[model samples]
Target: MLKTESLPVLMLMGPTASGKTQLAMDLYDSFPIEIISVDSALIYQGMDIGTAKPTSAEQAAYPHHLIDILSPSETYSAAEFVTDARKLIKDTHHKGKIPLLVGGTMLYFKALLEGLSPLPKADEHLRAQILEKALEQGWPALHGFLKQVDPKTAQRLHENDGQRISRALEVYYLTDKPLSLLQEEKGPCWDYPTLQFALLPEDRGWLHERIARRFELMLEQGFIAEVESLMRRGDLSIDMPSMRSVGYRQAWEYLEGKCDKETFIFKGIAATRQLAKRQITWLRSWQGARLIDCQRSQSLSQRVILDLRSQIEKYPIFM
Candidate 1:
């Protein structure tokens, strides 16, 4: 029933361990589509086990784009993701295939769909000055300053959230304007139609169990060793984006002697649950997305596939 002149892009969104990848693979088998990973952690190489990245065999078979495209030492911004995903969407459409973007990174999805804020670029000197002040008075002091100038943004940011606080202050210093005002100017949205669906588990308890099990599986998969190996690289730090990922951050802290083994596991699982909670919260307020409530479904089965296909068929198709 898909009825648009332009090609339609498919978005398969879900929280951590919500069967997004498996569902996407199954959809690919049935529809003429290409998969693009929307995950922030999946962009870094050498982060497979911790990130639950697709295996080499699975990726080779399915051909996921934008995975393992950067090293853990580097950084990729949401703006970059918007550019890459838009180009990939256009290319996939040119190839006569729908682009299926699947992942838990709601920020990337939102930026791609709603466009980005017109924030100023990072100034190294300004950031260094902010960091120096933070070193002397601590980040909480900066938070107080932020509250005075941009109380709206300050209300949302944690006092210890150095990165975001620094960026917000830097924006104020550069433009002499508050960050909140600039964000309200939301740049430009994508033009093509998109078919959006998010897998919403009916039971919260079941989702938590899945998250705990997944974290345990990650441990069994040498997740600790993976972090250790990356740390040994002498280039990565806990503050780096890749190392700051949910599990990786906790694991890195454990390795740094900040916590015991049991505490590490508990914190890791808890952090993952928090991440899933945030993702679900984002989807709860997502506009133009169908929330498919599935019961006792960790992985999408034949029944789910057929049901989803039928739902997809109900939409208008490109002629």
Candidate 2:
């Protein structure tokens, strides 16, 4: 069995379209490692196109955990993620392989790497009520209501972001506590040694261009068709977490008769660019470890493998 002192974890993070997934797969091919995804969007089943989840072929190539294991209908919170990831990390360590955590979900990574304060389970009734109100009153009306209850969270989130606004209000109603207070008390609580690496593209403009291109590629790959299938199910609502994801949200509008194909393409790319921007800002705030500019790094695979090996050797995980 691997002791906490011996089996160090490797965390590979980066913004969307930074080539982290391809690099992680490359490293997996070279090393004895198991991947535990940190992506929030990838957790939902049937959310393949937008979340960029590894295809079945890729999973056959390398073992990946915590991905495509949940349905959008279920409530998967960060607290729940931390619990499962820590267990998976321990399990992988027992099998004598490195637990390689990979993805772009900052919240999940932060909660897992640091620790999360205990928060009350979401009041589903309250959540449903909030959504019903939003459908009738619109996001601005709901946002206005949140401002009355929790001005701090309301100010931080945009008025049109119905999902987050509802969540914040639901938290307050459930626990009688401000979401901000819960955040301050949470952090990575483990003593296990961990190495964090980020694959950053040096050129912002280049990354934005790549983001736009990726959305177009998804379109060509039948992104809308995927949404149409879900729409036909009628069980998947736009309020679901998976549905709120970047490209899926815009495509959902087209499926709902809210937009034409042209508008969907245009808005999808714009939303993806915005998501990339948020990801970049989130990565900057991460401290420690290494930052590789994947855009400029020659032979990123070689460099990351060498780096991973060096970190393992330097740390010397003991059993």
Provide the TM-score for each candidate, comma-separated: 0.82, 0.81
Point out where model 2 deviates above 4 Å.
Answer: 125-188, 315-319
Q: What are the per-residue Cα lDDT tens digits for candidate 2 across 144-234?
A: 9888877888889999998899888888888888787776787557767788888888888888888888888787887778878777776
- Give the whole-model CA lDDT for all candidates, comma-separated: 0.88, 0.82
lDDT of candidate 1 at residue 100, scale 0 to 100: 90
What's the residue-level lDDT of 131 in candidate 2? Answer: 93
Worst 10 residues of 1 by lDDT: 310-319
Q: How accurate is candidate 2 locally (lDDT)?
A: 0.82
Deviation from native of the Cα of residue 195 in model 1, angstroms:
0.8
Model 2 misses residue 46 by how many Å? 1.2
